[model samples]
Structure formats: C-alpha cells, structure tokens
Target: MFEELSQYLGWTNCFPEGESFLVIAEGTDCGFILQHFIHTFLKRKLPVCLVSTSQTFSHYSQAGIKIGANLDKAREEKSIHLVDLMSKFLNHYTGQIECDWNAKNIYLSIKEELDSMEISANSILIVDDISVLSSLCLSIDDIGNLLHYLHALSKQRGFNILMSIPSLDCEQVQDTQSIAEHYADTVLCVKSLQTGYSKEVHGQIEVVKGGRSNCGVRQYKLSDKNLHLFARGTSMAVL
Candidate 1:
C-alpha cells in the first residue's frame, strides 16, 4: 500500500520530490496514518507541517523523538513542524463558534507560518479535519478560500499539503472534497466496509481523483503505531 501511495504521489525512489498529496480518512485516527506513511516510506528527513484542530501532536512528535533517540539517519533526516489552528483560535472561546477577531487571528497565524516556510521545497502541511474548523466558524465559501490559499502556497513553494475531512459530515465533506478534487494534485479516501454478515471492518482505501492510473480499492489496517495496507486478497481486523 505504501508503494502504491508513493507511486500515486509520483515518488520514483524512496524519497518523493516535489509532489503534494491530500488524504481524507473517515475517522479519528487519520493523524496516525499520516505519520506512519511519512516515516516508513520517505525514510529521509523532510519538513513536515501539520495544521490541525486537534490538540495532540504526540503522534508525529513521538515519531521524531524515537528516530532521534535511535540516532537513526531517518530521524535526523526529516523535520516535523505542527500548527494547531483550532487550539490557537478556540483557546479563548469556551464554546464552538469562534468570533470574527479570533478567526482573523488564526488566519494571520497560518499565513505567517506559510510565509516563513516559503523556501523549503519538501515541506508538507497536514490539515487534519477541515470539517472541525468549518463547523466552528467559517462558512463554506470562506473555507474554500482558505483551501485555495493553502493550495497556492503549496504550489508556489513546491511542497505537499495533506488535508483530512470526515466522511459523515456530508455538507462539509462534499465542500472540502470538492476543493481538494479541483485544486489538489491527489486525493486518497479511507473508509470502512462490511465483508460479510458477521464481520464489519475499517480497511479500505481508494483514490478518488488526481494523477494517472487508479490503484483501485485496497485493504488497510491501523494499529497504535501505523496504518498498513494489504494487497487485494488480504483481510484485516477492524478498529
């Protein structure tokens, strides 16, 4: 699965150069999958920037620390950066909606981050669950504009941006998915399926759009540490 994903992203060798990817995982553990993909496949030091509504940076941070602890080349090889837009914006608010002032502040902060990283060619931006942000304050069009801005920044800087959305949030899901389909270079959708009468599992990944050939739907498995993909015939347990 990693090989196919690497191929989809136009990665010719172990390290991919100058390509951006967006993956939408259906559930809460999307961050885990993202971290695993970067660490296991890239196996080199690259700049990774995660923009999320979620508070925990533990996954990537731990990966970095582990790699650093072992003094592995892969650890020293890549740099991990995180931007918590949700926490930054909603820290003051006790509720869901963010005021106009807060929203502007969040946007400014993200803009500043992008400006600072403009020179790195291999940088990656992971926007985990855009639906959370849209639900909090921004309208559909506003979110669209934000996505467009990010897309432009990725292209101009030659970096990749990975954005995730919930499949259940139909409205925001569609809106976010559309932005990705139209502007993103690649789109990966991770979902679940019922294999038979007795078993229901979370183990399917499909490339809905972007790039050349479709890898079709394949089986995926998630553990505490990594998200593994299987060939067409393999079976796995659900989360």
Candidate 2:
C-alpha cells in the first residue's frame, strides 16, 4: 500500500530491532500512518500487537483489508493480536483479552499474554491514540508512569512499540503527551499538507526525534483507501 513511502524513507530496513517510536498526527491522518507502519511490519512477518483505545477491532480489520493485510487470518495464525480497550467505546467488551479500562490493568494483561506466547521479545505494540486515555480523566502522572513502564518493557524484551498522539493540545493532556514523546526511541509527526500546489498529497511526516540519519519531511497522500508518499522537491527537513 505504501511502496513509494517505504522507498522514499528507506523504511524497508530502517526500523532497527528493539526500537520504540512515537507518532503524532492530526485526525484521520493518524490512522493512515498506523496502517502504513502495520503494513510494513506484516511484510516482514513480524508479530504485531495493537492496543486500541479509540476504535473497535472491526474498524481496523476493514482498514487492514484495504492494505491486503488479512487480519482475520493473521489472528487465526497467531501472527497478530488486537488488545482492544475500546470495549466501553463499542458499548460492550471487545478486547480479545478483556481487562479493566485502566493502564495498569491493560499492561498487566498484555505482559501476561505475551509471556505465555513466548514471543514477548522482538515484537511490535501499536497504540491507537494516547489522548483518549486523557479523555478517561487519567492524571498526567498516571499517563507518564504508564509510558515509563511501557518503555522499560520494550527494553527488557527486544520489542518495539509505535504510539500515536495529537501534536496540538492544551493543559494536562499536553503534559502527558510531552512525556510520552520523551520516552520514545524515535518520534514521527504528521501534519496536514503544507504545500498548496498539489491536491494528490494530503500531508507530510516529520522525524521530530531520533530517526535514521538524513530522515526528513516527505509529501504524503492519504485517502479513504490508501496512503502514498513522494519525495520532496526541496529540502524542508524538520530538523
């Protein structure tokens, strides 16, 4: 789905082992970035785990279908796990491994499940959006602690985690988001397309923190079905 994006960013071999990343983007665009990342991981036949906070399993399944990611098959094959926390958001229990709606509970459940699978190391964990946790009225300290624990887990095991959050915000939410970014090994920021000359492109992704050397802004096109990436004509490196 993102052949060009992968080529442009050299992502095919960029994400090193055991690295954790933070992705921040505008609404809708966040979904595209996550889908693109998931596609890349699936190509490598790696174990993918998702902790959904804003959407149900079905929504992501449909999205994965568009990218030729047979999520249902992946689940049956145990190649992927969707640890959903949006049960309440979906009006009932939806998590494959149900747990309380708090971060501690979610973390404990995931850790236990991964341990049982014996593939806790060398895996990927994708979080839909952290801001939704703020909406749950979780304190900033609680959010920070959660991030710290997740970060430590990633290091202990040889796994990577890619989390998404909104870049623009105010108040306590902003504080939590900032701390999350700080814990990440790499950071990506996606914003609405800045160039006015092209309608095919929807936005650009910036490497806000640690990333492969020479990583910079690249024009991206996000639609209802796919995400496309193009090299920039000029050097507008976010660094």
Q: Top model by lDDT, which number?
A: 2
Q: Which pairs clash (backbone N, Cα, C closer than 3 Å) in model 2?
A: none
- The local distance difference test score of each candidate is 0.59, 0.72
lDDT of 2: 0.72
Tell me which residue pairs clash in candidate 1: 45-77, 45-78, 46-78
Query: After superposition on all CA atoms, how large is the RMSD of candidate 2?
Result: 4.6
lDDT of 1 by residue, 1-239 (tens): 24444554445564544455667666434554565455643454555665767646654566545433221333344344556666656664765754563345556667676665534666667776676765665777777777777777677777766777666657776776777667756677766554532232345777755464366776665544334566656664332
TM-score of each prediction = 0.74, 0.83
- Number of backbone-clashing residue pairs for each candidate, in the order shown: 3, 0
For all predictions, the C-alpha RMSD in Å is 4.9, 4.6
Model 1: per-residue Cα lDDT at residue 219? 67
